[model samples]
Target: MTANENNTNGYLVGTTLERMLKAGHFAVTGELGSPQSAHGEEIRAKAALLKGYADGVNLTDNQTAIVRISSIAAGAILVQEGLEPIIQMTCRDRNRLAIQADLLGAYALGMRNLLCLTGDHQIFGNHPTAKHVFDIDSIQLVQMVADMRDKKVFQCGDEFKGIEPRFFVGAASAPLADPLDFRPYRLAKKINAGANFIQTQLVYDVPAFAKFMEKVREMGLHEKTSILVGVGPLKSAGMARYMKNNVPGIDVPDEIIDRMTAAGKGEPWFGKKNAEMTKEEKRARSKARREEGIQVCIDLIKELREIEGVAGVHIMAIEWEKAVKPIVEGAGLYPRPSV
Candidate 1:
């Protein structure tokens, strides 16, 4: 079906992320944090809840280099539940054959949107003891997928059927973490390497993001590929601090932190405590932080959407799926895209 008819039908058409990237207005998407364990019931329930509010849900594959269910497997489950699943495939845990086989399997199951990544090191995740796999990095992964879809055959001689996947493929980049002047160059390289779209790591500096977009425009990439800026609601000053200091490739500016600090301080709306807390107590104080975060995120999305070349926002609430609906609704985006 045509994209227009899919839009009129109230469901995203063509393919999941393909249609989303093609939306005229900025598209809004979200991720599903993998379950701590492979509890089918819990995973299923989260799928049901997030299905309504997000364009599609991204399933991480052993995210942060920790061991868990593979993203392709979890994606199959999400597809079975009638939710568009953007499978997050990383090269850290699999070789070319494993990755190719899984891609074919996902296509067979009707799951197509894929966010390819180099993945995190084994030392960073819950299972620090696990062995690492780095046979192919993300750019290589993108090229591999391009080869499969465009060529219709793997290096192993496995032939794929049906239309070439036409998978709406994306890769992760860190404009905020890299040297500011060099980000566009890096982005250009990735685009040339076969990245169809880019999902940037958490962005806190809107002006910096604007500059990055400008640089990308100068490279002429803005017109050729879709760019989705990643936004995570800062739950508190402490969490904001953590993002600034700990999250690699994510730069949280002092001004934004100050704004978050001032926005919810001592202002109890809806009868909730709103006191400033120290870093040690941020987790305990998250209730108030979350309230503040959602509002901040809604405002941020509004601002980010206004940037010249930004195609969309990727809202990642981490384990906060319940908050996604309210934030999106508060941001004036309801009846979320179903492509």
Candidate 2:
């Protein structure tokens, strides 16, 4: 049995998220990027925006290699704020012992969900010179955490000194990543390693994503783990194009980019005349684009919901937590299920 299925009386790790999914509610999860300072109030303020909107709030661990409030600390703050916090643990910075200690403390602090990530390489972060500690890859991290919860043993194969940490283990997936044909098999490894749920990279091309899910369903991975497709607002046309052209594993269709472009160009011209618009007009266009992005995300959620293997949607309104309520309600996923 996986960590999620080893509770005292029955299955379920006793987390709100695990129970929600087990009960078959189309789950909704949101991301909360911890600020770069140690301001507890900032974490509380963001949690306020996410509290009722998401079944679980993910606290990113030093996302983009930039130093921020640690996910564990922020997760504790979230627990105090009365929200379910998903602690994102990355192998990029910590060794196995450090990870185990953090997990123990995280569980003691009332965080029951964990997301295992290899993390963005340090090269992309502000501290490029900082060394990395890929002591174990993400898949192994999942196995290790699962072992602790289910077998009640440490990664060292020793019996737990006391009650073991029982986490609703989660991992990430990128359906559109390179070597596309291998993505399904790679996902199987995670499932086999004991991922209770998966949060995938943001996807804009529904048909392409559906194709990937078709393969996943063929393998019956969906039945083994809850799959939550990632969806997010584009913010601006530039943001859409940047992810499409530059970001790996993200497949933003030209139609999405075109729609974002249209949102910005509410006027009739796409030429030099557009450049002559005043700053006020520019600001108005940006606002319109953000609204359109939200609508697009809502529509995508609706579409993804119909796909057979999709258990729910993970709305990543990065730095735009305020938009989550509207997007969730827009997609008819509001009144967040109370499991």
Candidate 3:
């Protein structure tokens, strides 16, 4: 079906992310983190850097539960800048009322894509004393949004007078997370919940992710929804090890660490023997490792695109915006679709 049949907005009817995916394009999306300060210019500046490289940019919703500008406002700004935005919404801070209200506002702001997340707990954020209100989970949120678009009613079954918001709903996935066997089933549930697309958590273990995809294919979930594998640059051996050890739902293999370490060998602060090296030396090594990381990401994207049921790659160069262009170009996904 064409995008127009699924949306009412004139500006977003047939030329947004929804259409791109429906047309079977190899879509590329990037994540944009809002600055802590309320400077709109910074947000625009960062988005400008990704203008041509990414098909759409994900405006994080207080990512990690840290307070920042609203994803709705950021998405509006991105729309004004001639960029498509995937406004992210989480259930950590808002109740059902607030979530529905913001969904309406986001659609009014010309946003065509929405990503529903359950969000990290408040304890993980800077404010440990804050309370959370997860009135609904991500799956429910996806269903609610879909209902608003398709059924023309709210979760309470209240009908609207005018136009209902038309959104291409999306959700998150962690293929390598614990209870690996259940991950594909969870994906099926999300699809049943109205998730049209899914972007997975960062993947560093290729074989494990491949196994997960095998299950995904086995269930034929990929035929129902588009799957975008998440890939990012590692920066350094220190960073790779930190994600593997500290980050939840992330699995980084030792070989990647070894590659990063080996890439930084020419630097004076290559190994533990140089632990006492000056800050400048360490920075130099980190820079070298980042280059290697970019190449690694490029290779991963190439491999992921070859896999069955994989629609595209989501390059999340978190805080490393400048690296996105190179990574996309290197992966040969540049000159992105005009739509």
Per-candidate Cα lDDT values, in order, are 0.76, 0.90, 0.87
For model 1, residues 209-304, the per-residue Cα lDDT tens digits are 887787788889888778888988877777888878888777788877876677536643422444654554554446666777888888888888
Ranking of all candidate structures by their lDDT, best first: 2, 3, 1
Q: Whole-model lDDT for model 2 versus the true structure? A: 0.90
Top TM-score hit: 2
Error of 3 at 232 (Å): 1.1
| Candidate 2 lDDT by residue in tens digits, 127-219 | 999999999999999999999988889999999866789889999999999999999998999999999999999989999999999999999
**In candidate 3, what residue range of length 10 has the lowest lDDT sum?**
4-13
Ordering by TM-score: 2, 3, 1
**Tens-digit lDDT track for model 3 on 1-339?**
454344344433344666777778898999898888789998898998899998789999988878888899999899999988989999999999999998888887789899899998989888889989999999999999989987888999998777778788899999888787889999999999988889999988888888889989999999998899999998888889999999877978888888887987755577645658787886777678889999999998988888889988888987888889999999998888766
Off by over 4 Å in 3: 1-15, 267-283
TM-score of 2: 0.95
User: Which lDDT value does model 3 have at 100?
Assistant: 92
